[model samples]
Target: MADRVTVIGWDGSPLTAAACGALGAATLVAGAAHHLALPEVPASAERIRLGSVDLAARRIAGHRGTAVVLADGDPGFFGVVRTLRGPEFGLEVEVVPAVSPVAAAFARAGMPWDDAHVVVAHPRTLRRAVNVCRAHTKVAVLTSPGAGPAELGLLMEGVHRTFVICEELGTDHEQVTVLTSDKAADHTWRDPNVVIVVGGPVGATEGGGWIAGRDPAAGPRGWTRPAQVYGGELGEGERDVLRAAQLARLGPRLGDLVWDIGCGSGAFATEAAAAGAAVIAVDLDPRSCARTEAAARRFGVQLQIVLGTAPHVLENLPEPDVVRIGGGGAAVVSAVADRRPQRIVTHAGTRDAAERVGRDLSEHGYHVECALLQSVDLDTRAWTETERSVAFLLSGELTRS
Candidate 1:
């Protein structure tokens, strides 16, 4: 009996005479339940249903006679072959690969997958898979029993991704459905499916050209942006004043995480996100939260928006290196002061709010600096006359005396 390992690929096809002969003489066979059900397994051979990759590897190592390990689709591409032949097992594996599910799914959809980011949405790793879909353009998610279309669809609710659910590939019951993330949530899909997330605008070309093992936008363009060009929904006149005052107070820098409280339209949050710092924008108004999300998408930066009241909402969040309170009351300012950010900036329309925030920072052992800016936009009359209205801008930065 040959004491060697043989890996085989199965695709619901009848086992060839040669394959039957090999399996009939084999001393041990290991595979999933579906693979073990194939008629090719020798009646006398010991069968091990692959429960875990580690257990399967152990069984293969202990086997003395000719052993065959069965795998689904292509074992080389995000499959079981890698785990079986790793250093711990050290067993030589002869790879017999079939058409991978990803390839089959893309083929069924009549789309090219060279640019797709392939990920496995197993129960244990679904969060990372969701994050990949959130951050990347194209993705092929290998879904497991419960991590199928509905779950993935829910995970991708807010992000812009079109789903192509390819179920039961290479089988008689094969089906493919294309839907937006919202519609996918309502539809139940079959198991052993591959979900393709089309990236970019639904009808636009995906990310243009691609590079090997590199993100589409991975190059000289590093993250982060200045406050002036943050590009919120503000009018030209309002934007000018807010941009000037925000830059003067917040003073964002590289690698720093900033919190934008009461982040209306997320202008400050977008600016900080563009600057390469992680940003979280919170607002009580649901519309504002939606607007913030839209602005972040337009700018191609990651800005998390939480729709809720501040102070209470900020309680559970991670500490920030810098905080800018665009709207909130004294309690919100005091709560932010307790976090002791390296810098704290607040825009105040009233003198009382400004004085309260300044005093709170001072009481927290910070040397508070305050500034007020008044700007007026001129309106031309029929005779080319000018009219003006002034708005107060108060900003404060806290530093240790």
Candidate 2:
């Protein structure tokens, strides 16, 4: 058992004086092949090739002399330092870190990255990283072997994004290439890469910031919007009271996908987007799509507008955590339910329609609930004006047979 362990971070740069001294004095040194083969690491040190990091940590713990571990940049960040300090190992370790691949990638691109979201995609969870890119304006993905730039580009087909791919950062073979997501997909990318996806209106110089993505602290103050604030006919608009209840039921949050099927005037979709959910508003009527887009802009929210009939159109859209069916019939409800979203909220014009939706949801193993919502507004003349509405709010967990 060495008295203490030293972990040195290498980013293909010359080692610092402290790192050099630690490596020279180390009785046991552990690192990947590249780190072990480095000319600066003293040849006399007992080298342990890093394969299963846990096994290496155990070996370091049992060694009765000073040990040094070499890792890629900023070991504390998605690197080996977490495992070394975890309860399983619990080695009292000193860390000497270098610039992380993430920071290096952004620096090479000459972009201010404080507002960029950073996601790591190993082979198993690449889909989640891609989804984050789909939802946000800017993202940095630290890639794994099989889940490199091409795989990421495949998932970003429809998203408007520019990809800055940095391969083998801080090395002799280092190369940086900028491509569109489509272009990135068509070509084979080198390994040991970092992908930066930038979308929206971020141009050559978007200034600087201190936060990553939208500040969680600065979210929509209030989602309730009066009818007159939106464009188009109020004939198909959802009342603010009903909208509030539906928003609550949907529970839209960051990194969630919400589909507003048959979105009329885009009220529900816009409100959900305001609440930080990635929203898709689908409608058959061109007018409805226009209205939805207008409302999205009016509320300073981003919306993906799909102009088509439901069930058919929804087949190709991204999977949703929550869905609001405002205009479609029972068939539409059935179609959306088939996708197995976490929650579905639909309002109907007739009791038969509401009952049919409830039954359909019940058949899908959802706990169904129906309600008749009404509100009375105080007019300028001190008279009470009343409006009544009915909706079927359904929620269910997927029972995979």
For model 1, residues 1-401, the per-residue Cα lDDT tens digits are 22877777765566656567667777899888888887878878899998898888888887788888887788788877888888888788776667888888888889877766688888776755765665445678999987887888876655567888988886778889988877887987888789998755331224445553224354224233333443444532235565556755677654356788887766767666555455778889998788788777766656667878988988877567778777777888888888888787766666786687777778876777656666554554544435333434545455663
lDDT of each: 0.71, 0.80
Give model 1's TM-score versus the native structure: 0.61
- Winning candidate number (TM-score): 2
For candidate 2, give the lDDT. Answer: 0.80
Give per-residue lDDT, candidate 2, residue 308: 90
Off by over 4 Å in 2: 202-210, 217-220, 233-237, 298-300, 349-351, 369-372, 380-383, 386-390, 399-401
TM-score on alpha carbons, each prediction: 0.61, 0.88
TM-score of 2: 0.88
What clash pairs does model 2 have? 1-63
For candidate 2, write residues 1-401 as lDDT tens digits.
77779999999999999999999899889999889998878878889999889999999888989999999888888898888887877699999999999999999999878878788888777766876776667789999887889888887666678899999898899999998888887887777889998876432223554456666544346666777777644543387777887887778886678888888888888888766677888999999899988887665566788999878888888778788888777788899889888888877666776787788888987777777776666675757665555444444445542
For model 2, what is the error of residue 127's alpha carbon versus the real structure, in angstroms, after optimal superposition? 2.2
Over 4 Å off, model 1: 12-25, 199-220, 225-401
